[model samples]
Target: MNLKILTLDEFSRIDFINLVNKVFEDYTVPIKWDVVSFQLDVKENSISLSDSFVFLKDNIPFGFIVVSIRKEKARIDAMGVIKEERGTGAASYILEHTVNYLKWRGIRKIQLEVVKDDIRAYKFYEKHGFREKRLLYSMILKKTINQEINYRYFPVEPRTAYIQALEIYFNGRKPNWQREPISLLLSDNRYNFTKIVTNSGEGYLVWGKLEKENVPIIDIVAKNNYTDILKASINFLKSQTNCKNILISSVPEDDYLYQPLKKVSFQSILTQSEMEKEIF
Candidate 1:
C-alpha cells in the first residue's frame, strides 16, 4: 500500500473537488460542492492550494486537507479521509506534515472547528495538542418577527460595514474565522449592508440576498443597544426579502451577538468547538 502526500495545487481543480466530496461524503454535515461553490470557498476563505495537501493511495486520491493562511495565522478550513483510510495512520501523517510545513513557513498558530458532539474528532485533535478555544453556534430564525421596529436603518456600502465590523472585532469582540474581517472583505460584493443609529448607540448588519428561502446574516455588530439593533435588522431583512428563515453560522458563544440572537428567538441548531494549536 503505497501512500503519498502532495500539495493541493498538484491536482486539477475538478480532481480536488472530487476528493473533497468523497472524503466528506459521510461527514456529520455532508457537503457537496459544485465548481462555483468550491471556487467561492477558496476565494472567501483564503484557501491556499499550494499550502494545502491531498493524500493519495496508489495514485488514487484518498484524503485531503484544505488550509487557509492569513499572514502568520492559518486555519484548517476542512480535512477528511475516506472511511477506508480512517485507521491507517494517514490522518496523523497528514496533520504532522501539515503542521511542520506551517511551522517552517513561519506560521505561529493554526485553528480549526469540529462538531461539538463528534467525540472521535475532538479526541483526535486533543491528542494532537489542539485545545478548545471557544464554542461556536449555527443558529436559525424561522418564525417571523411580528414586533414593530422603532429605530431607522439605512443601507450602506460593504466597505462601511466592514470598517464597523473591524472596529468591533478589534475592540474586544471575538469572531470566528468565517466571520473575520478578511472574510467579510473577500466576499463583500455578495452581501448587502445596513446601519442603524439610535440614541443608545450604533450598529451595522451584513446579510446576503439569495434567491432561496434561507437568507444568511453574515455579520452583525453594534456598539450598544444590541437587542434592539438585532430586532430592527431582522425586521428590515424581513421587509426586503421573501425568505422563510434567517441563518447565522459559526457565531462564537462569547460574542456580543450570541445572547441577542437568543433573545430574538434564534435557536441554536448546531454547535462547534473552535480548537487551536500553536505551531511556533
Candidate 2:
C-alpha cells in the first residue's frame, strides 16, 4: 500500500472535523461528538505544542496519528485507523515507517499509552514495540459552572507576587517554557493575563488568543490552594464569551487539582503512559 505522511500544517488544510466526528458519533446509541478527546481534533496553532504527522493512503485519509518527537525520545499522542480500514495494514505500515523516520532523526525511544481498558490499543502498541510505561489517569469537568466558584481573576501582569504565589502552590521554580510565555504576555498588553485568587494566595493563567478559537493556550501556575485556584480558573473560562475551550498543557499526574476535576462532569478519554527506550 502506498502511504503519504503529512506534517501538522498539511493536516490542517483537510476537512478533518467530519472525519473525527464520524468516529465518535456513536457511543452506546447516542451521538457524542463532544466526547472526543481534546488532543485528537485541534486547530493548526493548537497542535504546535509539539510536532505531529498525519498519514494518508491513495490520496485519501483512512486514518491518521499524532506524535511528539524530541532529540532523544518521541511519544505517540493519539493514533487510529478507521474501523473499515483496520486490519488492512495501514496501522502497521505507518507505525513502522514513522519510527524509522524518528530514528533517523536521532530519537531513540518512542512511547505511548493504551487506555488500560482498550485491549485492541494495548495489543497494537505492544506489537509495535511500545512497552507498558505507566498507568496515566485523566479527568475532566463537564459541568463546572453549576456553582459560583469562589475565586477572583485579576487582569494584571504576572508580577513577582503572582509568580511567588505559583511557586508556593506548584512548589517549584517555574519551568522555563511557562515563564518565558508569561514574560511575553506581561510585556504585551494585547495578551490577557488572567490570575486567580484563593486563601492560599493566587495563581495565573498566562493566556490569550491569537486565532479564531477562544482557547488561549494555558500556562497555568499556582501556589497554595492549587485545586481551588485551578477550579476557579476553569470556571472562569467556562463563563467566557470569547473562548470555547481551555487547553492546559504539561499538568502533572499528582496535581492537587486532579481529584477535584474528577468530581465535576469531566470524562476520562485517554492517557499517555510515560515510556522510555535507549537507542545507543
Query: Which stretch of 10 consecutive residues in model 2 shows the poorest summed lDDT?
Result: 27-36
Which pairs of residues clash in candidate 2, taking residues 3 or more apart in a chain or in different chains?
A: 140-266, 141-266, 142-265, 142-266, 169-223, 169-224, 214-243
Task: Give the 10-residue window scoring lowest on summed lDDT in candidate 1.
Answer: 143-152
Q: How does residue 135 of candidate 1 score in lDDT? A: 95
Clashes of each: 0, 7
For model 1, the local distance difference test gives 0.85
lDDT of 2 by residue, 1-280 (tens): 6878777567653345455556435422222224233333232112333356666778777765666543465666555666787788877887777777778777777766555666676677777666764445544434335344587777776464345544543654423222333334234443466767866677776655534444543455655555566667777776763444444433335554455555544455455444444443
TM-score of each: 0.94, 0.58
Give the per-residue Cα lDDT of candidate 2 at 231: 66
Candidate of highest lDDT: 1
